[model samples]
Target chain A: MTLIAADFGKLGRSTLMSVASMLALAILAPVLVAALRADSIPAVKLNADQIAPRAIEELTGRNVTRDYAYAWRDLAAASESARADLLNDYFTGFAKDKLVRRIADQQKTGVRIRYIDHGHNVRALFYAPDGGEMQLVDNAQLEIEIRDGSKIIYREKVNQQYLVLMTPGADRWFVRSLDQLADHP
Target chain B: MAKMHSLVFVPALALSLVSSAQVPTLQVPARLIAGQAFTIPTHGQGEKTFYLLGPGSVVKRTVELGTEVKVTGAEIAAAGRYLALSCGSDGCSGTDFFVLPGDAVKISFLLHPSRVPVTAHNAINATAFVFDQFHNPVLRPVTVDFRVLPKNGPAFTKSVKTVQGVAWSEMSPAAKEGPVKVIATVGEQEEPRVIQQVASEACNLRIKARRTSKGVEVETDPVRDCHGNAVPDGTIVSVTAVDAQGRTTVDAPVKKGIARTQLPIHGSATISVASGVAIGNEIKL
Candidate 1:
């Protein structure tokens, strides 16, 4: 009986030792892995050649340079011949002295144009017939904003309402002028 | 015969008592490495019960599913003469089994650069985890593997770059530009980071055959700043590039308001701006 008890005790001791050792190994595994992590490969970097073109094209298209090209032509012509222009025409109850004074003041103060970014949503004003005339009544909706520093100088939506001079000879469209729509500020 | 029996019986009784008093007690010391997590469960039912005991008389440790724990130490004490461990929960019987410490949780988090658009020049930002086995993001010297394999063209792989502690890589450009995969690894962490990348996004560069004041020109667009924004003249700019093999190559000095070396071919150049440039309103290239 004594012999049997001794043997059982020895077996129990060995079993406990084995359990302890196994536990020790388990505890060490994560430490070993983390220590050796530096030998592992780092995340890779790729060339940006593929993504740049698409971003540039997308940004350019959204800015409306090609679409509003006709706006420049109308503004340039009307500004030169202020007498024939409706907004500048003296007979339309609009005074040339006020118009010239505004132009002279703009030249003196260097009043520039700018765009406003209304977060994700954008709204703006443009002018009729390329935006050269100073008629405050003929503003249209603009697709984009023209800016000068922090100030919003012009927009597309406002001018688009009064004048439909987008097509040059009913085909090509260009911005005739930039001064059609002016920001209040 | 009675005297002899008495002598033997007394010794036997004393020996039994002594043996019973010599129960072997044990306590195992352990620590959970930082930056890692582990899980341990002990369950018992009916007469057979199990108890997972820890330090500070803490009992009935509940381990939820998907939860990880850190082990500090373990002790085994019993009343038997043998070194047998008995697991018990109140009235339930308990068996002493080996408990392993959690080790897998210690590995660092590796990350991959997000998908950026393709540019004339190709570059990407990649990073690796900066941690040890203890789930601590400690700074350590590590080997990093960066790979940029072209998806459409020839296969190209770069040598492993050695990084110290945690640092970002310079802009790396590729000769051939197209769809490609970027992979990074550090320690046990692989591509797609446990954390963010160290480097910034690679710049997209292009060479345009544009109408210049001097004549028809094949050069990078002047309107777009180093960041590729349409800026007027006099905007300060800087451009940097890295190759496919993780080799950084900065261009020679920029003369005449242009800041980068132009490739003879029309397409293929990745550019990134570090500082000093503004985007203009009109085509101000």
Candidate 2:
């Protein structure tokens, strides 16, 4: 009876060791497979040409360019009462006030400034680290007519350069300042 | 006492004579056209130098007083307000006048968009600016006739009066696909322009598909409008495939003439296509 009991204990110890080894293999098998699979796959290195056509740097600048075009169009197309409402989307602070005053003065003088054709080239000058402010320089060709009362007193083609400051708002970028560079013709 | 009185009286008399001398009077026309000969009348004695200042020009000449100063078109070519000053040994006087625009010599006509889709209430604007020979904008109210010639359709005509040197009108494009000719006429001067009219949208869009090695290849017939005109290239056509696994969609643009896409199908599926708001017939595979 002692020999038989000692033999049963030895068998139990061997069976426990086998079960523990099996359990450890079961746990480590998935990790080993995953590592091997990861090693088999090639590392991806993206070239500049493979990047998206519209880079992150250009996204905000494009919005400002489109808004600038619309702002000038609204100025030429809106009525007296509607001018302020139309321009509210494009300008802010002192720029907005200045545009409003200019429109009012034009209305009082019976002056209508019509924009015939406008084309512009925008170059990004600076972008703030916080992404709050942006500066752009625009070189533009403008065909315009200046009318006084019932007479178009002046008509010409003008080449203009502007230093534009913009700030991001809740919906779109707003023009903080549009100062005309005096050096351009 | 007599000599003292004469001294005081002589100085006073001289002062009165100088002050009483008639100031030169200048006569100028109230309105003059640009690039036209004009004359300014002055009244005085002895030779007087006159300076004429106007937009884009300046003239200084000595002329006999009581005569007129003649100016040619080249001298007073620019249209704006002008000032003429007469300065003599006796006194100085000045007068101002306005220069108006001359007759229409050329027309600047602009048509927006350069292309349009044929739909009612889709408006295209035509704006005209009449200019003089010297390129000055003519301010007078002139009648302008706008004519639109459509392919295989009746031509449209309208007359508009210029206000502040501009005449603009809005017209709807014809309901057909072809080149459109627009002409603006004022007297003998005419400006001709062209705009391309394209089909409105895709209608009756239908597609067919067959099994391929890669996936289920599906392609649309040449898309057409209700009038049977082929939809222009680059119009977006959307294709959707629905199977046991959910749905996949591809928005393909029309190239050459059709929009085609391949979808991987697991089991029996349904395919549908659409262009703009127009939906096409669906097929079960």
Candidate 3:
């Protein structure tokens, strides 16, 4: 939490005390709300124009978008809480292994990350003929905060690009890979 | 190749710091290999906390502001975007960079249709995704070799080009009914999958009949499929005989490549045989 203390030296003693308290609370309230509230589903728009071998069925398109949103929500929650089990629902294979390792590493180094997801524009690049895997390019908007315990070390808003791979499981689509790209189309 | 991605930290909370214009900028490589050690030169004085965030890792350390900060290769082994941040009393300055994958050394191969009929066309599919040692997909194009080794034919190999780390090819089943092994190769990595090619519908299912003590003994010649493959033993073969005693039918299982059955017939009799969708020649006795 940050309070406006720059101008407090010029103000009166009592006024300065009250103003500092108000400023601290005002800034602290939003941070608390943002951290404590449950992560809502982020908007995910999928474009399958380039998918090959088989055109994406309408139902598959709907299901993939909804599941991708759920994955983002879960990812945000997992990163903030450093809870690896939370990823089991929507993550599998390499994606799950990497995030789980990251959480473990975070706990070791006393570091944490928070992702405030905005939305995503995902383009489907490849769909295996046998329906085992799908590759996508995702352009995402997110606010990321790196923290050392209660101290916010760095925060930024980024337009990130990711190479994503999703595989179908028994009940839902699982994210197998989510690799950040350097703005390549 | 040296590539770099830089991120200037923008405020996420209400806490505003020194204007981004005044915040000290640091020097870092534009691009890095997936598993290589690197350093960032810091400026100013005093000690500051350095945090390196990347895929599958979060590294934090305290270093003297003016000295070079050493980052181990294991800290940022995963390929993707990485952020290097230095936090001091004045606030933090963050820069982002990219880590590209190494050469394609591994492959995840998927072969479909574990069993198919010999008559099927383009029934086997092989799709392979190339990867680095760290399990990151290699975005660059590469050629994948698909080797087909049939149970009873000369083996052949075909090459396909990967698009965005994935390549696929479809193959027709060999005429000979047996198992075919398909192997996908990338660099030194090889993955193999096997699919069975079973016989198609049985054809040339003609049977000969002769009078026996108990009844008319009818036995079929060797049953072969349209592709000339011997029908597998235990396949059902139906035999029917018609006489003054009305019609008699017996469903017999082929054993030793042929099926034999007895049907009680009186006086003149007509006999016929069938297997699957193929009908055999009729015999009159």
Candidate 4:
């Protein structure tokens, strides 16, 4: 009888473990799917071979690339949702001001835009001697969509060019200026 | 990209986009310049929603179909890609355009090392960032005029063509130490920065010793730099005296212009004075 009781206890523990695992999976499934469907950061290929004044350090290059990708992600999210707060992390100075104002305009007119970024090929144009500022040109592959209320208004895929200026602050790089060029691939 | 009046720029950008139709369609001008107003043509009838998006500007409003939609200069002062959309019953049709930055009229100048030694070689960095009136970086190759003015020396000028909106020049502080003013100009805009060129290391340090009742007293001649400028007061001057017993050293600060120290000993000794990289003559007492 004692051996039977021990066997029953092992069965009970095993059942409990199985139930817990199933419950955990069930609870996390939606979140996992949502995260996967959420905005993915676009790849950025940074070419620093021709930067003047000084060469970029490996760590700096990595940080710049990561931060630039994050910036684009935030830009897409903020423009789509009309939430200016998302831009505060990676945009500063005139860049932030412009984006925030655009968000406000969208709120006023109930217009929305979303950037579906594919990737970017960026070339380093200038690097300040003191490392305070860096400028680059980015050729981006993107699919842009504009919406009005519940209606989809405009959509297109294009290879766009941009002139970007970044400054270091708070242990990261901030986009000070992001201007687009009229070049097509 | 003509020079449009600044007054009409705002209204042009304000009405830059609109379309009228059950299925909206719009056509934008081929060329747009920052801080310049523009007009666009739209198709369809009745009222429709207009939206314009750019790097630093966003415009959204209702517009009457078949009429011109104008954009204001203030609204389009930032240079970048612009999208103009017109939404109607059927769907939305839009056109995209690029706005080039206007001529550079401002210079943001950065000059490093506010204070440098006269002997420093290429220690002054002068970098100029050219900008349009809208504070947009000018991308074209504009010439930036650089003038370097040094106290007690001839002033010279150099012109550098900007690449990617920036131009830089490195300068060596003149041999005569004083204030050096660096100026950068783009079009009608000028930015000037000042740097102080101070004396370099002490030179020709000399020491004199005289017999005192207790021992020997040593003093340095007025400490001067190689350029004959008196070394600033409070500079450390080391005095070392060696005798039969051992060596006695006194670290003294230059007062007025000279440094003095007293060695308390009974016998004769050799005294030497040194300041910075300059070693003075030794004296036998």
lDDT agreement with native, every candidate: 0.29, 0.65, 0.83, 0.80
lDDT of 3 by residue, A1-185 (tens): 13456455545678878888999999878565444535589999999876786688898888888888999898988888887888989999989999999998888887888898889998887787778888887888888877888887767777777878998888889999998876441
Better of 2 and 4 by DockQ: 4
Off by over 4 Å in 2: A1-185, B1-22, B29-31, B39-50, B55-70, B87-91, B244-247, B264-267
- Can you give the TM-score per candidate against the true fold? 0.21, 0.51, 0.77, 0.75
Ten residues in a row with the worst lDDT in model 2 chain B? B7-16
Answer with 1 or 2, whichever has the higher TM-score: 2
Q: Which digits, one per residue and each the tens of the lDDT, describe model 1 over residues A91-169?
A: 1111222233333433333332222211111112121122121111122222333222343322332222121111122
Q: Highest DockQ, which number?
A: 3
Q: Is the docking of candidate 2 incorrect, acceptable, medium or high quality?
A: incorrect
lDDT of 4 by residue, B101-189 (tens): 88899888888888888888988888888888887878778999889988787889989988767888888888876888888988888
Off by over 4 Å in 1: A1-185, B1-123, B130-142, B152-168, B175-177, B187-189, B192-285
Interface RMSD for candidates 1 onward, in order: 46.9, 27.2, 7.4, 9.7
CAPRI verdict (incorrect, acceptable, medium, high) for model 1 = incorrect
Against the true structure, what is model 1's DockQ?
0.01
lDDT of 1 at A165: 18
DockQ of 4: 0.18
Clashing residue pairs, backbone N/CA/C < 3 A, model 2: none
Candidate order, TM-score descending: 3, 4, 2, 1
Error of 2 at A159 (Å): 31
Weakest lDDT window of 10 consecutive positions for candidate 3 chain B: B1-10
**Predicted candidate 1 versus true structure: per-residue lDDT over B38-123, tens digit per residue:** 33432323332112321111223333323332333222110001111222232122222222222222323222233333332233
